[model samples]
Target chain A: MITKSIMIVGVGGQGTLLTSRILGGIMQEAGYDVKLSEVHGMAQRGGSVVTFVRYGEMVAEPIVEEGQADVLIAFERLEALRYAHFLKKDGVLIVNDWRIDPITVVTGAAEYPENIIDELGRKHKVYAIDAMKEALALGNSKTFNVIVLGAAAKHMDFAKEDWLKVIEKTVPSKTVEINQKAFLVGYES
Target chain B: MAEKKIMLGNEAIARGAYEAGVKVSAAYPGTPSTEISESIVKYDEVYAEWSPNEKVAMEVAIGASISGVRAMASMKHVGVNVASDPLYTASYTGVGRGLVLVAADDPGLYSSQNEQDTRCVARAAQVPVLEPSDSQEAKDFMKFAFEMSEKYDTPVIVRTTTRLSHSQGMVVLEERQEVPDKPYERNIGKFVMMPGMAKGRHVYVEKRMEAMSEDGGGFFVNRAEYRDTSIGFITSGIPYQYVREVFPEASVLKLGMVNPLPRKMIEEFASKVDKLYIFEELEPVIEEQVKSWGIEAAGKEIFTRQGEYSANMLRRILLSEEVTEAQAAQVPARPPILCPGCPHRSVFSVLKKLKIHAAGDIGCYTLGAVAPLSVIDTTICMGASISSLHGMEMAKGKEYVKNWVAVIGDSTFMHTGVNSLMNTVYNQGTGTVIIVDNSTTGMTGHQDHAATGKTLKGKTVPAISIYHFCKAIGIEHVVEVDAFDLPLLEKVIQEETERDEVSVIITKAPCVLLKGNHFPDVCVPVPEKCKKCGACLKPGCPALTKKEDGSIAIDATMCNGCGLCMQLCPFDAIAKEPK
Candidate 1:
């Protein structure tokens, strides 16, 4: 009935932009007034990054405010923990269960928290999956974001056929089949 | 229904330039503004080129305007400071044709050194500024700015914030408005800026400001929307969107023309509302003006003058609602790091090993200040690395900088480092400048510069050799070394810094992220040979991590086979394998 805001949070270089592009393409094709806000600069160098996607009859603000996100998709466990607060009280959180040590962890200054999924699952509705394992099963680790996006698709307001059509047009020609397969693996999970 | 598409604000700005019949566009690649030229090049009609820096870009646009054609230059806010020399003059001289300068301001410091508002600069130069709220407006305002420029005979600045530039929104496509080229008439009194002519032009500039300010009240870009009179917001650009989101029914005077703010419209709106509030990010450009008119407005007292503002801010401030925010989970911080196998990592690794302090410049090399590779002592701006080092040497003499060197990227070296290099040579200063020649602008996503031998329009030109540029500038000692060859690089850095005269050491390596860059091998960890001593992890390459088994593991996917980790490993625990 109102504008739906989706927040995509992930570590930079983890194909966060690809998933945002796919979502943007789908939203526009669906004839919704969509706006996506992204950060482009020095921050993309493996820092925690976010892309806000909002669509509805009329979208006003580009950024999804704290506690206003209807859905939040994360590509890394730490990033999910970082931005999970942006989700609404009953918002759905689909997260990839993966770990990449930050410089702090490498330097022994901080510890990567344990039981992040369990902690978040107790608060917000959480769907945690090891997307890296799924992508590795597909023989290409880079398609992990497509798998995560597929898992989150069931929560969004789009049909399977619409997703398939957009995916075909969005991805590169050579990787279309693999991305399709990757999306289905998460869709059926 | 009209055909519409979603694009970046930068892209929309480019489309606006194309549709308005712009003939020439020049820019220097900086974040949030780089994509403008990237998109502008797709149109075959416009002759777009990426100049060496922003000053050159501003001059190019001024020259093009004087040649009787609509022209523009785009850059991040700091670049405007470099180009302000010509910008201030262009304001006085006016334009032969409509000229627009698109300055993208980074209010949140997303990718910039400072969060300076371009509107502040506009007020100083006495130029008018038009700010758009969304993608469609980004296009519409560009066209309007040209018309406004030619009508007023003054250069127009179309300013956009990071939120406006990087955001993507739906925009209705439009046909090109093919404006006829203006005839260039010989008017020395108007074009020339000598003392006598400049004095007359100064009066003309003041008159233009007065006229623009009066017209600004009724300008199409400025609008007054009425709903609730109890509270009102006078906002512009992206902040206007927040007012809509937070208080949909509140009366608003959305000032699209930020500079030369509509005084009459603002006063009238203030009279209608019971209480008025001014909302602007970065600097209080709007609030200060509205307040100076003896009108009361509540703004920075409750709102921050730093970073981006949002709907939630207005909700908590104006509405006085107790909004419960979800508690953010505590987690390890993930700061931006150098990409695995980045050539800067290799060079920085050697610098860290030599225990040398570096006067760092911008680019991916700035990340060297982060973790285990923390060798950079300071990072001021683009070319401040060399100049600051010269300052340090001049301040403390040559003996103080015995263990110091200036590290800069190739693109930054071209930007302003060359000028600093000449200053060092002319002033008889002895300092070492390491030109980290990664062959592209690494930080801003690898846009080709002069040394890259490529143009913004994808044309292949004779690449300017950095080595020759250094030698031709009368620098006596200059050398080129492979970035990945750790031993040789270390030796070269040591020899150069020890020298008496000014020297340039060019480290040659292509950025790992560049397209068509292929690695013949991948680095793998030999678990059995691992001593678990952690020497290889000192460089802080993201690919090397400590496994629970007390051994280092290599992420084969991210490694570029640069062998920096292997070179660092005392036990030869890491091996390069064929992919």
Candidate 2:
């Protein structure tokens, strides 16, 4: 099988680690040889962070290089715009239409980009979800990443029940029900 | 089929250590290497600890090894520098049982201050280092490294880069192989590193190196993958994966043991391939040695010795193929900052208000050097802050350093900042040292330290008091102030700095992310009370932003109820609204 590459881009402390763990769990459940590369420590303190997940019959590189990602799941619009080039020509771009002004913007060193989702749509297929708004509507804002994952689930090979099983196992036992419901919200959307 | 589970490279190494029957493990928390001890501590059979510093950790492992048990010490690349004193000597003394160190290097400077390679240090110490490519090899090579350590009668290092340490891949689970502990023998000539004894052991070290080099090829860790003979790459660790990604069918001489060059394997691989290239991250340790042997291999010339190597790098350099991919959008860089209610922000804000530059040490406080607060002037490793401030005082006299205060986290202070403070006391240097006591270690993801009153295994222990530590070190004016209490923090800092004697201000606050830390209040903006004064935004907290109408607003989700802005607001425009 050809190696399927997925990139998760977000601001640190945006629950990217949990999202990647959930992603890794689903791929492992699918019995694919998966390699996930993550960054921890300094980068986790409100900085831009990215995790690379590649799975196939035999995966080689742990990192998904520029123009190699089959799916780019970004939690922030600015982050999506930043890592847009990493997406393959036909790759799906799933962004959680949210904005968290970076320190540079907070310090007025640089301007936050405008209409990032639309700008990305100009060149690539974009699936933008207001996961945060939807998650807040669901009464839990942290499960927004799972919703974004659900939105991207329509493109992946895994089944709904399989995704539910992994999500249940991946999240805390108390969070299992809410997370499953959140995933369905995205998956059905 | 074996039971295979996905594990992070660090976790796999821990599993390998468990399988190898390591009895004791010690380490200081550092990126890439922290999780190794973290993962291993879960095994009931193995005893693990968070040693205050890398040197202490290395020596702890060495002591365990001398006590006839298999032991290990893991630390990041810079930590290797701290552990080097013991590590260099251990290479000669070797192990009583099997001693292995996991030194994770950050080639890309992803989480480090510098991109220092561990292999370069291993080579200087004359130790054999194993480089594993994936989680499976990270586990397998760890077992192999311990065996090699006992076989060669020399300490061995398993060198992993950030990519190898952080990546998660499939690893086959294996049962623990219980290795018998060797009975301790009194060999004063070996254990005791007297100059005379060291002279004899030094000769043995050279012989051990020669033996390791000769037998290196036979060690299963080094192998040749014969595919297309047109191009051959001699690579190791994570770079090997990149090689496989770029040239799937190309011949590769993968060296798991990187320190001692397997000459025979290199010669055989070089003879078969028409062109040979050495692909290694950071320093040209392998390429220089291979080149010295009168073998021509292209490395570091076309390839950079900086940062991480990638498949696209090989495609661009080797094939000379230009990537026509879209350029990454020029966006505002999201540099890591102190979290919304980070106590460092409060301390740094006070320092900024007083226009006092801080000599910063490692940890989250280092971010204070960044814009807005910009209170820190210099940062040079852990514990350097206190000593460097003392140095400035010695150089420019006592009054010169009054403008500068040393700032270090509680964990970092316990690491080595305590010693620097002691030195200041001994040497009669006057400088105000701010022990930003965030209780637990910050930046490295909140690992507990000695002062935090907890062990790695979650055991309750008497936490060391930084205030008492400063007092015990003979500092006359040691005081503690609440970090969020800005006026008190500013007053204490100013009072301490103005004192002619060495003084310390322990700014007390637990990290906001620490378990049991409750912020029941959120900083809410009173837009009507706002006078468009940018007083609150001076610290540049990401949570506080100015609206288009020029009035400040605090994002409730982001506002950690730090109340620094509330304290900073002159017109009482911001209030700490209960969540």
Candidate 3:
């Protein structure tokens, strides 16, 4: 089997790293070698955070070079645009259709960019979803990361059973039913 | 059947470490990472304690690890910076038992002074780095890191980001391993990092890394994906999955152990793909390494070197040239700031109003540097404020320094401010040091400190007061004033500054979020007797605002009234009405 790289990006407190954990569980349960790394900058003051996960046989480095990401799962739209260079030519880009403006952009020190998809059109196959909205529909507005994860899982080779099992293993039993349902919605959507 | 629990990423790390039979855990409390030790505290087996600072915490962990019991040390990214001196040597000295140091990074200045990357430290130490994306991974990685530590006889770093540390997810519980009670036979040369001993340890570290690369192949931590391989991605942590999400058909390589990376596995994967993209966060450590290996790759450049990434970020870089204006318009921005009714606000408010050039210290009180309050002038380290104020006083005569008060939090004062306080008294510097005692370490979710009179385990400890502490330090004028009493506080501050010798004002107030406290003062609006002189605006209270008619109105809903603005107003227009 070949190795594949994935990148997850979002603002701090948006569960970016939890998405990494869920994926890590799925990959581990699927019996694949996995290495996950995350970088958090100024996370306390509501800054952005990113997580990098590599899986498959014989994965070497912890980071993916520009234009080589097999998949890019973003919790925020603008964040998706921010790290687009990591996507390969045919890379799959699944982004939550949400934008969390940075402090500079919000305070008008910098102009908020207009279109994320247009900028990403040159090198990736982008699919945007209102994952946060779907998560809110699942009863918790914060579960947007899970919803996005579910959508990303749909195109992955890891079996649905393995994913579900890993999800069960990763999450508590109390919220298992809902998270599973959320995952299904994300997958089947 | 065992029950699974939904836990935060930090809790999972704690549980993971516990399951791995971690015997000793130490950390200095900081956001995005504080909960690791706190969660470990709930377990019966682990000896967990919040050390005085990150440096002490690292030393304690090192001492524990040397005892042959699996030990763990954790801190935020900056905390790791403080502990770097020990961390660098610890890697060379190696570990007797498993040692896992967790560096929880804060990207985007979430709660940090700057966005310094921790990956560089991982490489600098030449230790294996494990990055976990989610809660379960955080837990599993914790166990894997410990196992790797033992196998390699070196400390392993489990690097977690803010999202991974604070966000909650489901985690299946498992039986924990029993920890060995006895210490390992000590070899002074191996444990000690003196020049001669360190050289031998370094050679051993290199040998371990070689064995790990050879014997560690096909391990569960490294995996490969074969798909449409026109381009393949190599990434770790949470970003690995995002790469897969964005490029479903591309082959990908995911590496869990980042440092001393599994080179054999990476080379095999690189041969299949026509082009490679390295996906990681902050700096291009991996990308630079790949290039050094003579493998041309791309990452961080097209993807931007700063901030976090998402599918949209990847798509924008690789798919589209730019984002539509409308798409950008749809994004929402929420930035964290000092929570409303923060106790430190009043102290900074008085300082800013009095035009005092204050040297600020760490803690939640550091938010005083932000706009609207803009009270703090300089923030160097945890307890630098007091010493800085002393220097400023000595540098720029006492008269100029009188208007400059050093502001520090209660937890900070307990940490290192006491020495500076004694120095001020010893040298007879007539500087006014204002202790914003919020009754807790407010920056890190109100953790208990010595001043809080509570230990980590909820037991009562001796409570020390800045008031009495200053008095004992030979400051004859030690005054404890209500920080919310703005008028009285201003007068007291002025009086303290004019004093010939060293003095202090303990602006004491419980944090608004503190339980079981009644601070009934609410902002009262006066529409008639008001002149819009903007005196109340000078304090920049969030509750007070100018109405459309140019009269200052108070949003009772938003105000605790604290009556701070009332004191600033000369017209007696704003008064606290009985709630």
Write down the lDDT of every candidate, Cα atoms only. 0.91, 0.91, 0.77
Ranking by DockQ: 2, 1, 3
Model 2 clash pairs?
none
Query: What is each candidate's DockQ, to 2 decimals?
Result: 0.81, 0.86, 0.10
The DockQ for candidate 1, computed on C-alphas, is 0.81
Q: Per-residue CA lDDT of candidate 3, range A1-189, in tens? A: 878889887765567766788887777666666656564323433445667777776453455656668898888777787777667767899988875545445233455677777666655688778876787677776566788888998777888888888888878788788888888878888
Clashing pairs in 1: none
Model 1 ranges off by over 4 Å:
none
Cα-based lDDT at residue A18, candidate 1: 81
Comparison by DockQ, 1 against 3, better one: 1
Model 3: DockQ vs. true structure: 0.10
- TM-scores for all candidates: the values are 0.99, 0.99, 0.74
Q: Write the per-residue lDDT of candidate 2 for residues B449-474, one digit (tens) a residue.
A: 99888999989999888777777777
Ranking by TM-score: 2, 1, 3
Contacts from the true interface found in each model, as a fraction, amount to 0.84, 0.87, 0.14
**Candidate 3 residue-wise lDDT, B440-547, digit = tens:** 877676678777888777778788766777777678998898877877888999899888788888888887756765467765756677887777765455456565
lDDT of 1 by residue, B449-487 (tens): 999999999999999999999999899799999999888
Fnat, model 2, is 0.87
